[model samples]
Target: MNPVVYTVDLEVRWRDLDAFNHANNASYLGYIEEARVRWFKSLSADWAGETAAPIMAAVQVNYRRPVNWPETVRVELFAERVGNKSLTLGHRILSACDGDVLYCDGHTVLVWVDRGGQSVPLPDAVKAACAG
Candidate 1:
């Protein structure tokens, strides 16, 4: 796996948990979104156009353990591969300090699209950012 680990620490609120007191499955995707959005923002002047957030063509997530609320959790992201028109992004959820505690793992395929709804090559700026 060409895993590139990117960590994002999220503070769990009471509302983030379900009736069982663990983070809901859907919350994990939200965590991925946080990391992905941050990465895009950090990449200078590349994917940004006149409008719209990046689009996802596909995603795969694996839940390993339950995350309790009021705890600070870390979400780690990595890309398995980068294709001409799409990228395969993987994510691992942890407790930040404790890398051994894995809450889940996920992968997402983000396609480069334009306003006209066509797949384009990921801008050089973004590819460069990922390379580094």
Candidate 2:
């Protein structure tokens, strides 16, 4: 079954540009981070350290095209793999004005951890949410 995707729209800020006048590569990660946070919030997941939280374990991004300011981008997040203690979320950033234009694509691995920072089992609710 195809996993359900969570999406968020973000406007490219002028500050996100580099001297080259395109969105900086580092800024792409920030966009992904925002989308992830929004996705977690949508799930009502306790990600803010109430007890256990998900932490970034790894990230991989591929730049397909440059994004400029005065543009809106759509970020989509889907569960790629849900594991015992970690999950890989696949993401794509595209022009909100034209979904056909993909600006960046990537996946991030997040591990559930306790306050002590040791890996722990993912909550059932989180697993269910990732299922779709």
Which candidate wins on TM-score?
2
Error at 52, model 2, angstroms: 1.2
Off by over 4 Å in 2: 1-4
The C-alpha lDDT values of all candidates are 0.78, 0.88
lDDT of candidate 2 over 13-121, digit per residue (tens): 9999999899999999999999988877767746555789889999999999999888999999888998999989999999999999999998999999988988999
Query: How do the residues 1-132 of candidate 1 rate in per-residue lDDT, one tens digit apiece?
Result: 564646679887777788899988888888888888877777755565764235898888899989986778887777778787787888888887688998988799898787888777887766765675
The pairs that clash in candidate 2 are none
TM-score of each: 0.90, 0.93
Candidate 2's displacement at residue 102, Å, is 0.4
